[model samples]
Target: MSSPDVPSMTGVHVVVMGVSGSGKSTVAAALAERLTLPFGEGDEFHGERNRALMAAGVPLTDADRAPWLLAVRDWMSAQAPTGSVVACSALRRAYRDVLRGALGDVLFLEVDVPAAVLRARMSARTEHFMPVSLLDSQLATLEPLAADEPGARVDGSASPAAVVEACLAAVRLRCDA
Candidate 1:
C-alpha cells in the first residue's frame, strides 16, 4: 500500500535519520528547502577524532558518538525559534533521546533501505569520509523507531524527490495533528 499523506509543519525541528548511504542528506536538504527551514548536516558536528576514525574505516562506539550527538542536540535546541532540519545517523535510541531532550518538538524522518542498496550507494558515493566497510557496523547499531516513536518511515529506495515528498508529507501531517 502507498504511504499516507502528512500535513505541513509550521515551526518544527525535523531530524532526518538513517545509516550512511541511505540518502539522509539529500532528503533532509529537500525537506529543508520545501519547509523553508534552516538545515544542519550532522556530519559537520563530528569531532576530529570521530572523523579520523570513520575515515580509517572504523565504526564509532556509543562513547565516540556521544559528544557529536550532544553537539547536534545543542544546535537543534538553539534553532528552536526558527525550526530546522538536521541530517543525523541517530543510530541508537539513546542518541535520539538526547536530541529529543534538547529539542522538545523533535520529529524523526527515518530513511529505510536494504543493505545491498546502501552498499551500492556507498560504493558510488565520493568525497565522504564514511566508508562502505563501516556500513555493517552501522546497521548493527541502528535502533529503528518503535511503533510509538514520534516519526515517519520513508522508503529510501525511491528517487530523492520522492523521498523528500514523503518526508514533507509526514512532517505536515504531524504539524497539523
Candidate 2:
C-alpha cells in the first residue's frame, strides 16, 4: 500500500468509528482499498434482535450491543496479524477499548458529520436498518476519542475522495508517530 516514501502499515488495525449516517462504512471501505487491507463491515456483525430494535427506532442499550461489539472486536483481532480496516459505530470509550485492547495497535477514525447532515443522510438511505429517529440517541451516545487514544477525527461531510485523503493522511500521521 505504501511506496518508499510512506511507511507500510505492518501492524495497525484501523477502526472507522462514528454515529450512524456518519459515513463510517464508506470511509472505512475506501481507506481499506487505499491501504490494501481486508475490510470488515461492522453492521454485518449485528444480531437479528439488535437489528430489529434499531429498525423499530429503538436505541440499543450497552447490553444490547455488547455481543455484537465483541464479535467485531474478535474479527479484527483475528485479522490483527495482517491488520485490517473495519467500520463500526464504537460510540463509547468502553466499546472502543473492547476493540483496541485485544489488538496491539488500533487506530480509531471518528468520522464527524453534522447532525443535520446525518439526519439527511439517514433519511435518504433505504438499505440500512438504522432510522433517522435514532440519530439523536446515537449522537448522545458518542464519545470522542481522547488524547491518549490512537486515532484521529475526520470530517465526513466532505466528498468521498476528500474524506479518504484525510483518512489516509491521518493514518500516515498516526502510523508514523
Candidate 3:
C-alpha cells in the first residue's frame, strides 16, 4: 500500500528513534505498515523495574538502560535479516551504536519536534509509563545522530502520514546508496 513514488524497502532495518513525546511510536508503526515490515515496540522490551522507575518519575541511569538496550538490540538483530522497523528512544549515540553493532548498518529515523509540542504531547499521554516529569532528562540526554550515522531526521510536527512518507524516502535513499 505504499505510494509508487516511494522506493521499496527491501533490506532496510529502520529504527524510529527520538526522545519521549517525539511521536516515535506513531511514526514507526505507520512507517512499518507502509513498508509492509514487521514492527517492534521498544517500550515492550523494558523490564518491569525500569517501567516502574519511569512511572514514578525517576530517571533511569545508564546502568538501568543497558539491559533494556541490549534487549532492543537483540530484537532488532533478529528482524534485521528480514527487514523490519522498531520504535525506540535511542537518544544517545552510544545507544544507536549498540543497535548498529547488533543489526549491522541500521537506518535511524530521528523524529524531532519542538519543546512545546513535546511537552503538550507528554501532558496528553495517559496510560504510558513514562511521565512528563522525566521528559527534561530524556531531552537532556538526547544526542542528535552524528554526521557519520546512517540516518536522517524527520519533523515530528508533521502529519503522521507525511512523517511516514519522509521516513520511507530516507530509508530508500540510504538503502539505495
**Which predicted model would earn the best lDDT?**
2
- Per-residue lDDT for 1-177 in model 3, tens only? 457755556556789999999999999998888788889999999999999999999999989999999998888777765677899999899898888876545789999999889999999989889999998999999999887898999888988888888888888788767
Q: For candidate 2, lDDT tens digit of each residue in 1-177? A: 466544577667899999999998999999898888889999999999999999998999999999998999889888877788999999999999899865658899999999999999888998889989999999899999888888989999999889988999998888877
Q: Which candidate comes out best when scored by TM-score?
A: 2
Per-residue alpha-carbon lDDT of model 1 for 1-177, expressed as tens digits? 112343444346899999999999989988887777789999999999999999999888889998999999999988887788999999888898999976558999999999999999999988999999999999999999877878988999999999998888788778877
Q: Could you tell which candidate, 1 or 2, scores higher by TM-score?
A: 2
Q: What are the candidates' C-alpha RMSDs?
A: 3.9, 1.2, 1.7
Model 3: residue 13 alpha-carbon error in angstroms: 1.3
Stretches of candidate 3 above 4 Å error? 1-11
lDDT of each: 0.88, 0.89, 0.87
For model 3, give the 10-residue run with minimal summed lDDT.
Answer: 1-10
Candidate 1, pairs of clashing residues: 6-169, 6-173, 7-172, 7-173, 8-172
